[model samples]
Target: MSDTPIEFKDFIRIIGRGQRAGRTLTMLEAEQAMSMIINGQATAEQKGAFLMLLRVREETPEELTGFSQAFRAHTPTSITELSVDLDMGCYAGKRRHLPWFLLAVMLLAKNGKRVFLHGTHEPDSKRLYLKEVLPQIGFEVAQTPDQAKVALDTLGFAYMDLKHINPQLDGIIQLREQFGLRSCANTLARMLNPSNAAHSLQGIFHRKIDVKHRETAALLNDANVLCFRGEGGEVEFNPLRDVTLHLSRSAQQSSEEVKATCETFITKPQELDAKQLISIWNGELDDTYANYGVVGTLSLMLVLVDKLDWNVAYQQAQQMWQGRDKTWPVALPKYNLAAETFDTTGKHYAH
Candidate 1:
């Protein structure tokens, strides 16, 4: 690769060393390194090397913030201009359960909340993907920024795929199949918040990421961010697992959760089935755990908005779940990204 940031060694100097000798990229340094990758300045070898090196060391909050900033620079600035209540990111497809979270977002939409949900399905994943399910259920996904606004004006909600929103980040997210591990793009996608929505919620598979989401959003000065370790990493809850919500607002950070004075609900992960989402919403399935999952997930979002106390929010969530209309008529065809040996950037690997 032609060197821009440093003429000598460039990207490798950050990771091409023994553990003690290696260094993490500073905010600007990381942003510069990412610019090379996204701008097609880095060679394939450098891309792979850079991604794996950071994966081995793990990413820090500043590193995430820097990388995210570089990514945002490449994206259209107008996306953040749109106003929405919550920015919901759904990247990790659920492996062990139906997406109770999708229903919760839709319910909020049903009740006059503007929500923007975005995600991409992994090319090789067997998990129940929201990308496919949303379409399967007859929900139209916005392919462009303008279309997303239309959906919001009309339906009060919209689902967008990263493919259209920012193909650069989408390309990196698909790198998991090549590297067999996540890169900074995974974290980048969660922090996209394209609309710069005043409030945002993210779910992570790792406890550490739960904390990073709050810290980095605080750095970005996001008005409010609520993050927790989610079921299979999608912004849904496992009734059985205790949740610690890391919250960020006004540059101050704190951890919060519904006080749980009531009998806390619990459940084992259910078997995979997208159709189960419809049945559960219609109350035909009669699954105790699934019902509680939806209510608890909604309760968390209600608490995040702060219009009501935790107890009142919990009760409202319960009422919404009970009163949810059964005739939403959503259906899904299993969607697996059409197989591509190369990443979306069209960079071929020596397979």
Candidate 2:
């Protein structure tokens, strides 16, 4: 209750008050608060304080749903016309290993699933991003919604950077560097599901965040939402670690703990090479550990996509991997022969 006009500070006060008296924002309040920030109505100080306060506390499902709703309201609705079957969010870059979940995405695409992948061009220098790896693996990143439509229509998969999808949200996401810590922007971005897809896959770095995402999915009445603790917080499951999946399907929330498929941990390579993505897909690299990561993630996605039993899904994923077209993009109908090798600099360089 400051003497000055209420404005955004009202939200700041609600969440920033002493822990004893502080309260979570209701869905409508959170939505309105986020709308103010997104519409540039909140001052820089108010924005920083609001984000940091939410970051320090575990954001409630209502707050997440509200924030995401505000963001989705501003994004383009054109992608919905394409009827993307799966919505995958990638924000956290990989540090421990290559993003094996990407292989799972490609596998789904190869099997005729329309997938829309969205992520920020994260500024983290220590990690590997999808934008960087996609090109190295012979896939180009989409710069706009129209380009994404083309990719999805032709390849059954597309990765659009968050900046293009919603620049205001991406700007807030980039504030992580300035704050020296991640804020709720990252979590809210993952929850956008701009395409209004029936299924969504999200990876969380913290278990508490997983709960928030699960509960939020239920509140949003999402058809199928899967949240898991992914490798380096990217949506790729680590088969070596037992994974607890938080799911919200048909507006009901539940959880499942899938046992690790193996006991041995793969040794981290000294230098990261993304080109191995293609080699492994081509059957030139027989990497047991990498294969496990891919199959493990694919099985989890099957649970999301088809509602299959975990064990049965694992078996089916193995079979799918084994039967995969080794020649890959060459066999793909829209994969251009000239753009066989995409460069990391966002340029298409011919072989």
Candidate 3:
């Protein structure tokens, strides 16, 4: 590695010239550039240019792999024989809706699966974060790596804030609101699995990025990677319809070959909008809604991680939801969407 500090001008020169040359940054170069950018070593102009160029060109899987490696190197890691380690990275939420991921984590954790969710609550027009949501649900959000491991050992789930876990990457999130677009760092952040779990379920809004993620995960030789499009650009779990689920295994299968084995679920959007959908997350819905799309998604995760049969996974999730309280067993207060006021930038404020 070069010992010289990457100056702002040099950073701009490389990316600017690379753009003109129709060249992309190599993983090494991308790592160095991102490190400099995140560390506040780059000037405003350099940061703006780097983000804009990357957004327009998008990131190659190789660059993304390098970016993920760089991110993980700085992020805190925990070692545990967790049966199921899930990375739920959907930070942006529906403008006026609540997130179902939090509820899903609780239900899954209740059943003795170890789940870890990583995210930063800094999205534009930020909604509620796992930092706030987890504590309300009786899980303590850890402030350090050791604290995170301790929490996970005691509780089935733990929330690791990006800022505390990895401040450099957290700084990248701060740039998003100013840049008005997501850079490669945002995409790579989703792939940063500190627990080093072999199974991962990730959701992205842009369908095209799935290919990039697939290629990146393939390059890293990921064990099992499932990328999909979420409901309404939010990473919420929508039961009414089957979201696009892409499965990648570390077998001798090509990307296309692996995708062919995937089964699609298609449902009516209206079905998802029905009160039954809300009840599922709130724990008020019945088993009919269970074993449906959301449950099926959970089942797919189980198959990927523990090699549990699909039917078995489906039944387990359904039975757990059935036996739980109608409302989420946790004491977190319901998010009153109608009553909460948010600024244009997405910060929630009590009116």
Candidate 3 C-alpha RMSD relative to the actual structure: 5.9
For candidate 1, lDDT tens digit of each residue in 10-44?
Answer: 65776668679777777777777787788888877
Badly placed stretches (over 4 Å) of model 3 are 1-11, 18-20, 38-41, 77-84, 136-138, 232-236, 251-294, 308-316, 324-351
Question: Where does candidate 2 stray beyond 4 Å?
Answer: 1-6, 330-351
Against the true structure, whose lDDT is highest? Answer: 2
> What is the model-wide C-alpha lDDT for candidate 1?
0.75
lDDT string for model 2 (231-337, tens) is 77888878778888999997899999899897875776655577677789999998877899899889988999999989999999999999998885833223332
Query: In candidate 3, what residue range of length 10 has the lowest lDDT sum?
Result: 252-261
Q: What is the C-alpha lDDT of each candidate?
A: 0.75, 0.82, 0.60
Candidate 3's residue-wise lDDT over 13-43, tens digit each? Answer: 6556753655776777777877776567777
Say which candidate scores most in TM-score.
2
